[model samples]
Target: MSLRCALQLGIPDVINSHGKPMTLSELVAALPVHPTKTHHLYRLMRLLVHLGFFAMQKVADNHFQEGYLLTPASLLLLQDNPSISRPFVDLVLDPILIETNNCMSTWFQNDDPNPFVTVFGEPIWEHASHEASVNHLINRTKASDSSLIGRAVLVKCKGVFQGLNSLVDVAGGTGNMAKAIVDAFPDLKCTVLDLPHVVADLQGSKNLNFLGGDMFKAVPPADAILLKWTLHDWPDEECAKILKNCKEAITRNGKQQGGKVIIIDMVMGNQTWDSDDDKITEAQLLFDMEMMVCGIGKERNEKEWAKLFFDAGFSNYKINPVLGPRALIEVYP
Candidate 1:
């Protein structure tokens, strides 16, 4: 909550603007909080500093003796940062998610397939289908996440897109990933396939276009199909169907010599960071639960993923673990 409070207060950007460690008095004066509540700000900052969002430095001066500075984590949360994670926090902490979570215990006691269904008598998607405000927040959060991941993927995994002329971003929200790809490879044609509501009226560029369709029915033909953070929302049978359609799209299209399907999603047991912190592992587990609660899927281990690919009739595949909390998987026909 303190992290959320700091973000709500724009404390990181304020500290950044100061260009130096800011004393409590200076920080309070720079904030919009009530003058009578400056001590509350100090307490909040104390917790934030302890949580590593900000660093406290001991400084010697006549007027002030110590100050706070932004940490790397807080730097990424700054509103003006291109890779800001602010929207992610908002979505994760939104009342919709929290309310859904509150139903988990009752859902486990009942016959409901998922917590969301237990709470709202419908799938999360169906709920979003009617709530434009919630849908918009979902889009903002997804676009924000894609903006950060797209830039990193282009730099660290350019080879994934090498030699590809036509690509499709399956269930791609707002076409951020496809746009990034087309911007880097102007010759490559990129299409984003999603529900009608997702792609409706969305503009496209010279090498990029939008297609509204259900992946369970069909996917647009392309040399390569990209599914970033998409498959986790479904179970094995549905994922298999999507992969099968992807195969038919990439191979029958006659775009390349056995085209590939590139997937970016979490593989449950693949995390092996040397860093001893348990937070990442915990977050992954939480995400697995999120999939379970919001829809009909959970994170898979390597063997589970392999089984899904083989079940879809893919001859070969590769996993690249460069992305945080998720990996890039290339499935070949």
Candidate 2:
């Protein structure tokens, strides 16, 4: 709740733009708040400090001498940060998404597909389609996440797209991932495939195009297909069907033409070296639970992921441990 409060108040951005530690009086002046509510700001800051969002220190011998600074977690919440995660924080905390948590128990009692449906009377994707606000929230959150992933993919997994002449990003939200690839490899033609509504007003570049379609039905022919944080939203059987379609897409174009499918997702147990940091492991487990409650997906280990690849008729694969909890998986036909 404190985290939510801080986000609502834009505390991270306030301190970040200030360019220095912010004293309580300075923060209070910056906020569009009532003068009588100054004390409330200090109480809120105290709670956020205890929650590890901010660090407070006394700089002078006075009642309001305390100053607050952003912690590592809070830095990510800054709106101006290139890899800011504020949008994701906002989306998860939005009323529509939060209401789903309240209906979790009710969903378990009935035959509804998910708690989101019980609360909003529709699935997540459907709700996004009809509700403009929800759709914007989802897209903005995805765009922020993609910016972070883009840095990792370019720095660590550049080899994944090395020799590909053309590539397609399936379910690529807002084309952030595709934009990164295109900027890195100017010679490669990149395409983003998603629903029509998602790509309706989106513009493409000289070498990049947006094609709206369903992944289960068909995918555009490309030397390589990129699935970044996409497949995990579905169950194994459904993932298999999607992978099968990808395999067919690659084979139809000519399997001998050095075609491959690159996947970016979390692989549990892949971070054994970081076991000393219990917080990292705890976060991964928490995400697993979040997936269980919000979607049919769950993070998988190497073995589980390999099984899915083989089930989809892939002959060979390689897992390059690059991103922290996630990895760059190369699936070959």
Candidate 3:
């Protein structure tokens, strides 16, 4: 929670604005905190400095004061980065999610859809819809993730969007992913299809537009379909249905060439040459558990993914393990 505290206190922005190492006294004075919390703030800074979020500099005895400075890791946490995950951090650490963790054991013993339902008497999405803060958290978290992945797709993997005349981002909340894609590929016609509540009142650019609809019912036709961090929030059966629907959309949209559906989600237990890190494995497993806790979906290994693709009537597929734990899957009809 130290990272959250740092963000809540706006420490990174403050230090960046300071333009120099900010001493404890100077920081405490600048913060919008009570005078009694000055020493407490120092302790917090000391911990974050050790955690690599900030750097420590010891000043000369008489000339200046010893202070803290921003680190590269902390810079990403700034509100300015296109992929800033501050809202994501806030969503994960929110009281609702934290409390859900406490009900897992009981959840396994009971027949609740998820631990969240056990605690709040409804599914995560249902509760989110009723609570403004929860709704904002979910949308903001997805937008931040889209910003990061969209950037990576543009810089590291431009070939995916190459030669595509039109693209549709299924469940593209607030059109961040669609905007990012259309911005990079000026000639491509981009459409964002999401629920009305999420996409309502959102403006679109010349090449980007929003469509209010349900993915389960149907997805709009396009040369390529983008599903960023989308399918992981569903069970295998539902995912198969979604994939089948996407296949139909692609066939209907690009009848001559038969377009592909691009998915960005975790391919659990991925151990390619470059991604053999134990930490990544642990994180993948942790995410699977989180999925279980939410009663939505679980991460899939390559074998499980292949099974889903084949079941959904896919003829060919390719996995691009470029985005760390997450993989960009191209499934064709």
Best by the lDDT measure: 1
* lDDT agreement with native, every candidate: 0.87, 0.84, 0.85
Pairs that clash in candidate 3: none
lDDT of 3 by residue, 131-210 (tens): 87888889999988888888887787788888899988998998777878888889999999988777888888789998
Candidate 1 segments exceeding 4 Å error: 59-64
Question: Which candidate should be chosen as best, given TM-score against the real structure?
Answer: 1
Name the lDDT of candidate 2: 0.84
lDDT of 3: 0.85
Model 2: per-residue Cα lDDT over 1-333, one tens digit each: 667777878788888887767898889889887778778888888888887889976655554576788999888888778788888878777887678877789988999877887777777888789889988998998888888889888999887788788888999989998998899999999999999999999999999999999999998888888898888788899899889888887877675458999999887776655544455567668777667667778888889899999999998989897787677899998
Model 1, residue 330: what's the lDDT? 93
Clashes (backbone N, CA, C under 3 Å), per candidate, total 0, 0, 0
Considering lDDT, where higher is better, how would the candidates rank from best to worst?
A: 1, 3, 2
RMSD to the true structure for each prediction, in A, is 1.7, 2.4, 2.1
Candidate 1 at 289: error in angstroms?
1.3
- Give the better candidate number (1 or 3) by TM-score: 1
**If scored against the real structure, what TM-score would every candidate get?**
0.95, 0.92, 0.93
